[model samples]
Target: MVAHSAAKKDTGGGRESGSDAWKNYMRRQTITINYGRELPLAQGVEFKI
Candidate 1:
């Protein structure tokens, strides 16, 4: 699992003194597998390790 944060700022026109700030949060997941031997992977089929 991974966590990420992003911030954005927008400056207004026409006599605006301050800027608008926005934040975004996101999460992601990744999976990894280790194999002992090299084998061919077939689509729509399960292989036993």
Candidate 2:
């Protein structure tokens, strides 16, 4: 997910006056597996470690 916002910058020693801020959130997942020699290898089997 992502969000955007803006802020203003002041000419004086104040905060900037620009409303161009972006916030991003990320989600990730991981999986693990074990295989044996007796199992037959399939033609379209993707392996990840």
Candidate 3:
């Protein structure tokens, strides 16, 4: 499951050194991915967004 929370301000280091600092400084977001009817199970499983 995806959990949404606020993002912390990054000091910039490690793997994220060259990455956009704005991405880290931005607030958290919630994205709901829909797999639709492509899943094999009756309850819908294994499908991806």
TM-score of each: 0.15, 0.18, 0.16
Number of the candidate with higher TM-score, 2 or 3: 2
Task: Compare the candidates by TM-score and give the number of the best one.
Answer: 2
Which structure is stronger by lDDT: 1 or 3?
3
Error of 1 at 27 (Å): 44
- What do the candidate models score in CA lDDT, each in turn? 0.26, 0.30, 0.33
Runs in model 3 lying further than 4 Å from the true structure: 1-19, 28-49
Evaluate residue 14 in candidate 2 and report its C-alpha lDDT on the 0 to 100 scale.
30
Candidate 1 residue 28 Cα shift, in angstroms, is 38
The residue-by-residue lDDT of candidate 1 on 1-49, one tens digit each, is 0111122223223223222211111111111222222234545556665
Instruction: Report residue 34 deviation for candidate 1 (angstroms).
Output: 18
Q: Positional deviation of 11 in candidate 3, in angstroms?
A: 17
TM-score of 1: 0.15
Best-performing candidate as measured by lDDT: 3
Residue 47 C-alpha lDDT in model 3: 37
Query: Pairing residues by index, what is the TM-score of model 2?
Result: 0.18
lDDT of 3: 0.33
